[model samples]
Target: MTSTPTRSSDTTSSEYDSDDTNQSVHSDDTSSEDIEEVDEVVDNVAQGDPIWECQMCGALMWYQERKDNSRHSTVPKFQLCCGGGKVKLPLLEQPPQLLQDLLFGNQSPATKNFQTNIRTYNAMFSFTSPGMKMDTKINNGKGPPTLRMQGQTCHRVGSLLPLPGDSPKYAQLYIFDTDNEISNRMNSVRTNKDIDEEIVKKLKLMLDQNNVHAKVFRMAMDMLNDVNFQDVKVKLIADRKTDGRIYNKPTVSEVAALVLGDIDSASHRDIIMQGQSGNLQRIDEFHASYLSFQYPLIFPYGEDGYRPSILLRFVDDTDITKKKKLTIMHWLSFRLQRRKGEALTLLCSRKLLQQFSCDGYTMMEAERLNWLRRNQSKLRVGKYRQIAETPTTNNQSGPTLKGKRVVLPSTFVGSKRYMDQLYFDGMAISNDRPDIVARVFKIKFDELMKDLTKRHILGKVLAYMYTIEFQKRGLPHAHILVFLHPTSKYPTPADIDKIISAEIPDPKIHNELYNLVRSHMIHGVIP
Candidate 1:
């Protein structure tokens, strides 16, 4: 979200501030699944013990026992993967300095044959050192390794095969091993295509500002086509320089022309899709609170990673505003807290919650919650961050309880330092009286900010965004998303619809609805 411009009688508004030079990235997808719980348990052996413990997954072994044990076991004696050989030469080789030149094949061998046949009988017997052989180890010698040799005691871990570094085979290996996950992600924008023109025009119109910024572009394609994806294509579609009448703007590709220099060499298969669309459909009865009205939408917001343009499958009446509040207490960890950017705030209706078994959605893949240990194993758990928020039963306000309110500092909200998913509303002072234009732009905007202290929702309002769609003929109605306190309560759908219809910025935030004008855009097959 960016700055809003003052309204005028001008037919079309000016372009938004599109200089997204700061490059604010939409959230990146993350997973803590493979993060093993490591505990360093020094063996009870004496201080001088020769065993070197595996620091990886916390498994221990005595040098002799490890050398003699069988190789096949579910619980490996060593934590890290080992190269198969009778002896791992790199792991040993005393007089560390001498080992460097020998391993590098830089030093002259003791004998001619030793130089050419490093692992042959000729090299072993033709030593040029004073009195040494490759097959012999001296226990008490002050001489170099060339003078005192040891038997070949190589390791026998796996096959002594080198891993893939740059070959296509390596890429395929990693892809198949990870279920082709790397190829599916749209992390860097270099691969994603440009945004459509209609979408760019619409976003500028929706927010009512000039010079909007298109920061990041998100694109994704699932390995499984049937799986649900959200907001697949995203870009910072902000306003470019204004040209008065038309508010001429540069396309995402135009301002980002510098990056295009490398596009020809990039493979289309490698890059994922990004940016937004003008029309998108809603998911069926899945979310009761999400789509009370059918209206056009470009992106579908969800809890997981973004995918390209697609129709919604189910009605996800999830209340992000309320969910964000609980996320802090449930998901983040101290390490994560330090890294996650800000405290996220969202508005949600508490009463919409069906079952508060105190459990939250499970994460089979990318997760945005605080990391925790549930059963000694590193399994994920969405704890009891649930708080049912209901507006005053009596509409009475004197520190009286009509609804539940939990106030947490921005630091602890959502565990990380990220603030997003705000919730706010602006209804006209009177539903019966109509002050169409001025009230919609100015008055509503003022009331929107003023509603902050009212505890309409539970989080702080850092950034805000809303939409104004042309409902029937020429006039516009709004579908906005705000960024505020995580604990904010959800505004009911009925209240939201009534407020939005008046077009005075009176629509209440709905945890479960979309503008009716957006219904056609809700159902498209995801690529």
Candidate 2:
């Protein structure tokens, strides 16, 4: 066994027990290596001019302190937090600052302060912070009140707007684009000290009674999406300057002013829905996204013989088809029936429905619904089914019921030679709606395949057994489908409006409303 030689006696390997000798032998070799390593480190340190550098740990300590004050400085002591022991790691003073600012990111007194502030700001944007939290000013867990702005626009950048002579809208302007998602929850404070209290009042009302999501919130999100386009457009227009907020931008508080600070002049609603007297001839469904600008201009509900909060369905354009009239008739029929029984109606952008009026049909009072009730029994299922086993669209017709041998149509939409649609109000069936026991569509079946996994409207796939097509006169109309979720995320019409966006859909309460509206509409129009 190996043994360390002691001053008292030359080491002897003969006197250890077997186990003790085994341990002792290993320690002797290790201790010798440790001593050699320490000597080598000391030698390397002696080579530097003033101080020795320990290359292993990259330690630069003063050998001069050891040489000059051999008694005290050479043995500078360091304390262990625990009570067991103390240590001496040698003195290593960092160099004094010369141009510290440039090296330490403290180029100026201002820059030094900026760095500190940046650390604070970064805590919010970055996930690196451990205990960092977004202040109540920026992100209060309780969301802010939704503002209902009458005047706002919802158009994206580079999107085309309807114009004459087709030169294209050369200048993209964002003056009208913005959302009231600008919240009281923002970290920025505004002038209204009682804003929070006011919001609380509304929220309480909503919590206590309102059984639906806030419509205004949906509007705010739509506006926010539109804002991105405006932000990009305005930057280019200003070429990035004070005129553009993308430059040395204002604080969140200043943004509050830019958004909620000013209000526009209020005006007539007809101008909003249709257009100023001479502006409109017909509503162009394709260009309607820009119509957000006209929202405020839409007349208040009472202006056109409709009740308070009710606006004219259409403001301009006088072309109405017999089919459109009948469809509105059926809608009015359902609204009259259900609203009196329950407040059943749909919510959508007023711009889309501005020109939609039945005139005499729309002008009917709630009292008039009672008159229709006299013949309501005649509109019952058993009776109507027998009357309309057949359906007609332009020249296309479904097979007539041969004593209950009704040959269901193979599809709802097809090419001109084949379009077997069964929309309401064709010259066939004497312009009567038929009992639709079954329906199908030929093409664009993808629209009907529902996205089973999605939790949002955009996430859904088109669901169809077969696609149904609807046509107005001979022109294509937007497709109409229904969702009967065993557990739909949106259960009500208002719920649907809040959950979905620009793609507005009308959800009928029961099969009754569904079939009625279906009879009135022509699908296969929306691209």
Candidate 3:
């Protein structure tokens, strides 16, 4: 998740830190089993044989052919290291140039020095060389592309049939095809449109000066929208900045109720919703505890990633103080230790967050005992119920109350589901691909701008904002807010008709245009 400002009161709070920057939690202890195994294998392998090692944790491996060739498998099975990262093998020999450089220490120093000084020395020695004339007729690359921004004049991609009295359609297509010229032009336009730099500058100024008024927030938000969309809207209003409010802070459930319904009368609901909500809700106590171990949601006292915003999803009965203790103690005992391969496997598997929470509650119990022992002198008689109430049984048996604590599931599932349904989420092209969806949106936006500029539409664009969101079914759609140029703004019914249409086009009169419009432009019943 991107970093946002933490509550100002949290800066001095013993419960949580406000200024955590690191995202990753590394293991404090290293496993010795892999090291021993690798050392034993290393002693057996011949000196010149090829060996591969994991880059993450220094685990080594070797390829070995299986004897079961009759099974029809032709590939050798690789023995991977404990680190579970991509394997990289060392090059057996250095390159010729590197070897020469190391042995002779760079013999071309004089040549390098001469080349460096030659340009200036030659300028003094030769007259014409210093005052050489250059051709001024050559085209210096500048200005917008050859294609007009007007939609009517701009040719579509790959329309390559010859015209009757002019250049072939192929030639027109060739201009866009050469070296991906169209893509380059689109990229240039996108760069010019990007207002992130301006937004960041203004945002920093507003934050630093404590001038984050409602209008300032709206201005920053407006920068995220397009300038050529039909309609714009903002939701989820914030009345005031909640930066430093800690003592009088509202709980997550309270805030949710305030936003979603009447806060005074709102009742606690299950974190996970069932049925049509399609949420994995109503998690049992055991499952919730197990989840808490993995995610640190229940006892997130010392967890750097923990935020007050996360607790809003839980039921009212959850013991916040106890949860905090568990989270802190869990981290304290283990200190994030794990087998690298196992950790990775758990991270990527169906169980997503399994490693952090351990089996049984022995470690947690031990931690609690240690704390009780240390604080015995400070404790008021029968003050804390956890220790005072049924003290002997609670301490000995290890927190067996099934419903005593509840954990909410991570938001990862719903988020991934939404992204998976999207037609373009950047990940559609490749694992590492970025901005694919954004690029598609920008291209279509540019086309809209082109149409508006040429007066093919009723009004000129002044400014606008747009947002693309994925539906539950995984399709991507855009919501646009258009700001029209005042001079060309349409106020009458006839003026609106110039750009908006409801009836289907006449196939005979419109022909190709009719077919294109009918095929793509129809909307379903509004209600």
Candidate 4:
């Protein structure tokens, strides 16, 4: 059997090659060292073959293997990565004209520099690829090839140039086209029973009325719909300064006024009165604190604010004659100083800090266990008598009730609610098991046992045992031990070599298996 070549063969000859070869031959009269240097230069030039990039997949190919060989071909087409002109994809919409002109069209030094160093800019903004090394001589050339994953793998996008008559793709597709957006939303909601036709209609109306991007889309559409490009350009130039002057920028006070909304109003006065009388609710205090409402931006589901009692206590303690109220600045200063000292003191003792963390963890675990015990009746396995009495098709010959006590699941490590419960529904993984991972593992182990014992994957199996273990990273792995029949056991080196080989499989022959092994089985040195 012959193996297929990994890359295309370069068969095209050029005038450049002929000219270089002739020059090298004529220069042979020079010194031997000079002739050798000339030969090396010729070899280097020959190795520098012309490469063509695919217009569809951005994959590099030999110029000789290009689908289009026309003299005027600006964009080369290829057949290997994407089927020859078969794959039709929507194009990414061009950036706004102003942005395009600023970035690419302008002849300014900044623009020229940006265009020249675009790759550098991209590398600066994007993630860096890691460097890795592998020992190729580990187990000789016949052993498994040492491999190291040096970087993250990502999809290579094709050229951004829009195809003729192709619709906008990606974010632009959803942003600008209302009908397309609505249709997409409808398709997404088709399977959801809660969102009916009426709800969808209401949603469409809401999007039409309140969608913030609608104005931007309308402006873009207006630009596209202009009958005379010159007139639109003139109008834009004329209104540029006027538009800038007309746009009112809100001040800090104005923004505060908008958020607070008429402090002298009856509702505001009532809240103020409640606060003054020490009768304000926690919700009122929360709304009063600007920091607490905006805390979600920094920490999701987080709140930051002082309780009414704390504020009152601060005011009472600070006032010498109980006459003056503590100002916001004073309260903030006090809190900041208090927190700084506390943090510093905590940092001073490592053991004490560790003890605190351990105590907190212990408290949390205790609370979780208490909650589970209190809610045991809510779990499916709580009704152990009913489950024991229930007849099972597989257990017809065995006693229905083996024990009275409900056994807890071994898989529960208090990670999530689904994993913590003894039994979620009528179906129990064990007598009272939980967690999808545990269930999946059990099913897979059963399948393996069936293959070994019943299917006779390795002749007749005398005995077999397996243990599932979790690595330090919490990922589960299995170790299996099989005792095969005497006839099936590998007695010779040849038989052992046939059964077990430590090497990467040929990708061309076993593509799926090769990919699986490369992705999951390959291990590299930890940084």
- Provide the lDDT at 371 for model 2: 37
Cα lDDT tens digits, model 2, 476-509, are 2234455444565466788768656553245544
Each prediction's Cα lDDT score? 0.25, 0.26, 0.31, 0.36
TM-score (all chains, Cα) for each model: 0.13, 0.14, 0.15, 0.17
For candidate 2, give the lDDT of residue 158. 29
Candidate 2 vs candidate 4: which has greater lDDT?
4
* CA lDDT for candidate 4: 0.36
What are the per-residue Cα lDDT tens digits for candidate 4 across 1-527? 11111122363222232323212112223354543443344343443433344544344444334464432122335554333433222112233332244244557754454344332222221111112222335537576433322332111111111144544332123233446644444343223333334333443343234322222233434543455421221000000111111121212221121111124433331112110121211212212222222121111111122221221222221223442332233223222221111222222222323322332343334334554556666665655676557546864885555654433433346545446463444245333544665777779878988988998987899998888886544445788888999988988889889867797888999989988888767775322
Best by TM-score: 4
Please rank every candidate by lDDT, starting with the best. Answer: 4, 3, 2, 1
Error of 2 at 242 (Å): 46
Q: Tell me the spans in candidate 3 whose CA falls farther than 4 Å from its real position.
A: 1-435, 450-458, 471-475, 504-527
Tell me the tens digit of each residue's lDDT in model 3 across 1-527: 22111223433211212233222221334244533433334344432222322234333223231223223221222223311212211111221232223223435653333233322211111101101132223325664312111111111111121234433221122222224423332232212232223322332233223211222222322432335421322121111123211221222322211121122331222121111121122212222122221231112211121122212112243223423222333222222222323222122221212212332233344334445556555544344466345434534755555432211122223344345655344346433443564577568877876775554374677776778776443345778777877787788999788667687667888888777776566555321
